[model samples]
Target: MADGLLVFDGYCGFCTRSVGWARALDRRGRVEMRPYQEPGVPESIGTDAATCADAVQFRGPDGVRHGGAAAVNALLDTVTGTRVPTTVYRATAGLQERVYRWVADHRGRFPGMTPYCESHPSECAAST
Candidate 1:
């Protein structure tokens, strides 16, 4: 199988949790969650390291690079319940970019998706 690599910010709590959800949603196992900082991953995938730091990125086996929510849409295309949103993205090109950029800019503050440390301060003690 040609697994798609979904790269995200490892240090971000929201990104971490979001990725955990993505993994669960990826029932077909078409996606692999990877931290952008992982050694050789960025180089091997040939994605723009700087841009990936801003938002999620997915590198398909076909050598195409999809970033931001477009990347998310593509990565989750086969997963259940994502077809509509993905189609909306395809229908409206710039919409995904704006939404993805906004979310990326404010990822650290989104409710429920907040850094685990913020909600679980006590648990963070060990890691700190």
Candidate 2:
């Protein structure tokens, strides 16, 4: 878990479950998972809550930080050379940002997930 820190939305059902799934498959335990809401969580990884709320954040042991799909690539690229995320990161020459935005915008649509706004109306209003 020293290799990387992955910060995700703890309150989000989908995001929480996704992290659980990742933990199950993380053979080497290289990625440490933390929820953005936990006290002193993101700060430990050198990221702020706002940044983590907007996109998944990955902070490598080398101190490099990457967000969204790029964050995923930071974790999966070397271990799984041709994984779907890395492939998307490579294939989308110019639209990767849009993809991340879309995913965040529609995150509530994922199974078991409620829109951030609907679930935490006050928090979502502040974030947006």
Candidate 3:
């Protein structure tokens, strides 16, 4: 059985690229990924498009869902055998949100499929 699911935007070049990188680095094989837009997802997990519309989402050890940079940090900890120091991770949390927004805002320049849950698939699909 998989340890937990990382629900990600499969269509995003950045998300796919990052997952690939993490998979390579994850010697423990503790994490697995599912595209958030996939039909297999439980509505209880994402709820609505906007709530899980970020660059990344992860269901953690306790099965609680997490998103954005927190998900990324949790992945790092799961792979590295130690938690990322909270002081360092939280210190930049605010800035991380801004950066994530920027990436979400300009996802078109990304070189792969549209983000999995593009609010404007018409606009986003045109780019793909």
Q: What are the lDDT figures for the candidates, one per model? A: 0.72, 0.72, 0.65
lDDT of 1 by residue, 71-92 (tens): 8887777455457767877898
- Candidate 1 displacement at residue 67 in angstroms: 0.6
Worst 10 residues of 2 by lDDT: 119-128
RMSD values, in order shown: 5.2, 5.2, 5.4
Task: Tell me which residue pairs clash in candidate 3.
Answer: none
The candidates, ranked best first by lDDT, are 1, 2, 3
Question: The CA-based lDDT of model 2 is what?
Answer: 0.72
lDDT of 1 at 112: 41
TM-score of each: 0.77, 0.74, 0.73
Q: Please give me the total number of clashing residue pairs in predicted model 3.
A: 0
Q: Which one wins by lDDT: 2 or 3?
A: 2
